[model samples]
Target: MNDTVVPGRGDKGLLRNRVVEVENLTIRFGDFTAVDGVSFSVRKGEIFGFLGANGAGKTTTIRMLCGLLAPTSGVVRVGGLDFDDGGNGIKSIVGYMSQKFTLYDDLTVGENLDFAAGLRKLPAAAAEKRRAELFGMTGFDRPLTAKVSDLPGGIKQELALAAAMLHDPEIVFLDEPTSGVSPAARARFWGLIRRITAVGKTVIVTTHYMDEAEQCGRIALMRAGRIIALGSPDELKDSAFPGPMAEVDFQGSDPAAPIERLRKAPGLLALSPHGMRWHAAFSEGALMDAALSALPVSVRVRKIKPSLEDVFIRLAGGAQ
Candidate 1:
């Protein structure tokens, strides 16, 4: 309520709204199951990440939550109202930025903003004020008359976000908003997201980028239409693999032999190819050293911190 997105319930109990909730939500299309009994809750103002590979049902689940598709079974509640009974109500209170850029390429930025404002039924004067505020927040100063196609990818994304929030919706759903943006632009986009949360609006985003997962307050990792892991970044990493990871780099010979040796080493839980090197996970203490020793003398081994990508790959039923 103070216009800042706090994680979970803080000392102030600020996130009482529980902006989005799903329980055993399942969806199927002609016998192909999409979202399979997924359950999660997002607190007001928090950034909740829905992570999955391509074709992992993220879009299907989002559609159900947005009321664009009715679920085959289970329940969904948004903004304290049941999705079934208050689907339209939910739509009114929520803003969604789809994976594809939804702005009209042929229309000027100002025209698109005007159209969104009209759909939301904002008064002309209020629309002007909102546009000014949005331009100021996004630091986008191109003439509003310029066609959306003329703007850079980052600017287009910024405009889409501004359009989505035109009605000051209680919650925003971003489906891979940074997919095509440059690294610098992605950073800028995240800055905009932080600003939205500063205003107490919850943001639920799905992203395939593991580095982006680190940005969320909590991440739900999905696999084959099921949530295989869920927790804060550190919590998930610690609980999933309680060990120090080592990367073994070797040249002048095929790395397969040493990799296979490490795989069979005691206490080694998983071994994977990290680019040209091999990344091995082993529990802390003597076992890790033993696993390192198992590698051939030609291999150069060094301890490295396990990244969210590594964690995701391990949980997605991949080898190590």
Candidate 2:
């Protein structure tokens, strides 16, 4: 078992037990490489974030782990066993929820849970017990008779999660679970994620939301079918952009004008708009002097921390 955490785990160090291991993982389709030499390990009881833009191979990687798709190359180990030898066991121990809602719209919450339990072959009495426990865990108060389609987006997502966990899977993969939900709903959904980990279940999530990425114990940033960056959020930020960062607010009619001007300035590594202000990064030492001297005195500039988005933009070569 490889215990090392690539670039390293975060401050909490909650992800100490390794469960999923991928090495030199690659998948191809004719002339296109869907996943190219991707490798990473996920720890038990940790929230591992898999981040990338659309078509960046995040979903492809997840599919391989779930045994839904076979990799063209590389080794995938789950639960201390290889996928090839443990494919059936892996299927029984892991749950996957795709981006789209998979539950029947006309099915009630309880009915869906029952169907899920049937898929898992849970005994009738055990299924009832697990259903009640999941409802309590998710704070789902809707009537058992209420249709899933009539529920709010947040509640529907909750039901979907409950259905996935009906089999008591040790590892769960959520592909863009909070894609179309409100901020409040997203927050509530993250709360559910925390609860899942608290019970000793490991979660692997793929999300476009940076804020959601911040919640993970560690993340593997993928791009062009490869893992370009891997580490805790803070570690990735520091590693991606080692130089100092500044936020400048100028009294101007157009934010784009300052951005364009700063882009051509000497020693300016990268600059992007941040709400009413603009965040700029400068290289270390003497380079900072030139980048700052070029700024207009009329603008208000202050030192600021480099954000994960800034780091991603720099490492991924563009904003995702």
Candidate 3:
């Protein structure tokens, strides 16, 4: 279905009052190009995701957007300000939370917040007010004097996010925010993300987790420093496989034999084992039915919806 369009290839009209705009963005170090002419725009107050495996240039892109790293060539605009103009003032209106926790572990939670506020150069009175508001919203019931090093993993993540948003920036950048957290912690963290976006703050996050990618308003799948696909979760899934998908369970001695046999067929686009069953995609209509009939009658087949993982595998041409 050719879902591998360049980033922001088709959805230009839908992007109104964009909070971030990048055109022909490229970054290079010596001879290696980390980002290659990527183009995409992020809408205001929406969650934009960069979905890909490690070393796919997600962190590099985010760093460029946050003004920490300079792009070799491109047009980048954030909050109606040009990135080429040094982007010094842009730092005040944009918040960034890196993959690793950046706060001082030796200090108390309150002290960490104070340090962050100082870095932002906020006045003491304004910083106090913001601290009160953040603590209230985050339900930071732990003693402000408690050392950050002593907090639980989930609490540490929450505290990191709180520090990022202490200044109430209009735009937020979260780089792999849930890298080592548990599923329950991830869920709770995402809930916080939802509430933050609900209040009119734009969010740009990078993650390899498919479930987390599904939560974004839109996602751009990156591969080898390039965007191969971009769309909402449903749109990507629909365009990923232009055929019928089915989950099959074979009541046979060797599932491998049946899968290997099916691979040689003309209509089969992809076939892969899922536990005791197999998930396959085939050309629509007659071809699909024909492929199904070729399987042994002892097999059980049921049509199923394609998942994001399936879509990625098919688009990446790694189907098996």
Name the top TM-score candidate. 1
Question: Candidate 2: where is the Cα deviation over 4 Å?
Answer: 1-16, 253-261, 264-266
| Model 3 lDDT per residue over 1-320, tens place | 21222355447664545888877889999999999989888888899999887888999999888888888987777776656556676677899999977778999999999999999888989988988887787677898899999998878888898899988999999999898889998998898889889989999999878899889998988877888888888999888777889998986657777778878877787887777888888877578777778888889999998888887776654721
Structural similarity to truth (TM-score) of each candidate: 0.92, 0.90, 0.91
User: Which residue segments of model 3 deviate by more than 4 Å?
Assistant: 1-15, 317-320
- Order candidates by TM-score, high to low: 1, 3, 2
In lDDT terms, how accurate is model 2?
Answer: 0.84
Q: How many Å off is the CA of 238 in candidate 1?
A: 1.0
Cα lDDT tens digits for candidate 2, 1-320: 33323444544453446678788999999999999999888888989999888999999999889878878888887776556653676788898898887799988877888888899899989988988898899998999889988998888888899888888889999999999888999999999999999999999999999999999999999999999999999999888778888888887755565567778877677777777887788777367656666667777778888877887788785655
Better of 2 and 3 by lDDT: 2
TM-score of 1: 0.92
Clashing pairs in 2: none
The local lDDT score (0 to 100) that residue 264 gets in candidate 1 is: 77
